[model samples]
Target: MSTTPVNVQIPSDTEAPIIADFVEHALRVAYFDRQHWASLPSSDWDAPGVYILMTADGSSRVYVGQARKLRGRLQQHNNKEKLPWRRALAVKRDTTAGFNTAEIGYLEGRIAAELNALHQITVIEGQTSGDETLPKHMMISLDAFVKSILGALRLAGLDISRSNPQTLTEDEQPTSAPVPSNKPNKTVTVADLVSSGLLQAGQALFLSQAGKEAEGSVTADGEIIVRGVSYKSPSTAAAKALELQSSNGWMAWKVGSQSGPPLDMLRQQWLIQQTEEAEK
Candidate 1:
């Protein structure tokens, strides 16, 4: 529901057709003019759909679209104070005529399907799951991420969230010295892992988030469950790895038999060896 009322006004005399085309694309993908389409008695309210308006007066134009809670979305457009994307469309030519002009929505596909189908500048008060081609995780807001961070720190038994050692009741503080970092700030050269047989050709590991998924050696030494979700890790002993966005890599990633841990455990051993060697 990140909808903001955007108000970018391109002259109707010049932008009318452009608006129409934009609306047409968005109608197929992002938004719809639900009021006009669903108001009729014949319309099946239960059916998921979309509707939107295209702005044009014989020549130039603009297009505006909305979805999710159709009534609320459209109300924002009419009111010009929702998300900025909606406000941008509301000020086209005559404020009253923007919605009244040629509109399109619910032309084809389910509501989400149609909304995404249009590719229009969408203004909705809810999150739109990007298409099936995309991953499922939503972008968490900073506030939510912070809350999760606090929870994760507590779970890991780390006092990093606290301002000072005295903040704790003292029984919660660990008496042992903190573990030393084995990884040198220096980068591990690409050749290092290759020389150690950590990564094998056609090994099929995503090197990093940015790296392609083709194939790489199993150098990420860690014990990864075979049937459960496989996560990406910053280090061999990392408490948690960034969860893989694509396939359930836990099942997809394999070494010999699917029963034992992922080859990553062996890789993790290699990392531990390197860290110990560096410490010495």
Candidate 2:
């Protein structure tokens, strides 16, 4: 499937009971208090996804869960007052075909882990490591989706993390070619890689590690575009897509498919040919 750009719309006022919609990818997150949640229509949240209930008090307690139908699952929480959760963030895929059981299970486990790592909030829920047996590509897609959810939480004034979830940090930006004092640098672009027949225009590329996944495409001009942003080199593209300080794109991204050979393999082949010609 062709990768689409992610566009998330968040509300300006976090105090208001509102639903911040990620319109393009249909990753919808509704933030509301008890009264606002009770007033929402059940039909709108009938899809499968994960939900988070958090305390507004200074306790910073949270509960993460998954369900087939968010409406029914959340309703159960509303009837029971044991958790003392004052605010809720109900997340659901706003698409015709939404998440499956296994997908939500995977998200539940992943989200729980992310929260635990934050060290700010104490998860009130029991130990839940959901089913993680999913395809590589699917896991990558879900990881990106999870980022969107985290972004929404950040917008709602939750101190989830110190860094912005969506924005690439200054250190994460792609570095320029190194220019030596004696000689001018020969900048290597995706065009150079493709001219060597190592890559094709419009070829799909992906990076996956530690349950995080990112996708990009090789353009006709030899630049790799990730999340609608273009980069001059594969390393920069991989770093930007993966939101890392730096990455060796040639090794980080897989060409053509998720299970395909690492880009470095093709780079090695091209370097070998260059060496052979230089020796002659």
Candidate 3:
């Protein structure tokens, strides 16, 4: 399937309600709090769709289900005191000919399977019946629709990615590059340097370990840019390249020139300067 960007709309800045949709796929995502559930239009309740119930108290537990009547299903959930979820996200097909029970069931099953595979969040699977065969074209569309839903959830700070350990062959494993461990450096973290402004964006940095080296830079968004790839942290980049169980990127990476002092030294220097200025 072709990759396309999903458009997300936030109607109010103060509110958490969000609407994500793909103009071409007719798939729409609606995320709202429990109090705003009644604000949903009557059409959404009448439509056959999939909904995710999430805890409002910042928990990873969620309930996923398909409903022929979205409003009625949520109302039933409201009565269940055991289920402490207070927020909901729903996705539906917007078209003159709405989805049937079979189609919705298939989508619900597929979503449940994907969430289970991710193992990131606790998914409370809903009871859905029927196993209808979808056409090839419809299946492709469904796949795209699922991607949009996941993307929207991620945007909302819900991580639904697979993190399970899977065995791989030698060819499948990433090759480890040699990095140098010349002299043990002080304890300096990426966050420390960033918070102190000692490591600003667009600063050049180098990663050298196990006799291998890679050039990298800092981005405006506080991400590490290495060999044209952007990573959330230096350790992630190093781990991905070395195939190691874990890596401390700050200790392994050097700033500026290859012969320059370790990042920790720079951090220490910054700290000393801050202290001296404060004393003055």
TM-score for all predictions? 0.20, 0.57, 0.54
Judging by TM-score, tell me the better candidate of 1 and 2: 2
Residue range 36-147, candidate 3, lDDT tens digits = 7776677555588888888867668777788888877877777764468877888787777767887777677656655654555676754332244765445444644655
* Per-residue alpha-carbon lDDT of candidate 2 for residues 140-240, written as tens digits (9 for 90 to 100): 56665666777777766778863323322321212432223432224444676788777877678989865679998776556675654446567767776
**What are the RMSD figures for all models against the true structure?**
17.7, 9.4, 15.0
| Tens digits of per-residue lDDT for model 1, 152-243 | 22232322222212111211212232335654333332223445776442233332233322222222222221111121222321111223
Clashes of each: 49, 0, 9
Model 2: lowest-lDDT 10 consecutive positions: 164-173
TM-score, candidate number 3 = 0.54
Candidate 3 lDDT (Cα, 0 to 1): 0.63
Can you tell me which runs of candidate 1 are displaced by over 4 Å?
1-179, 184-193, 204-252
Question: RMSD (Cα, Å) of candidate 2?
Answer: 9.4
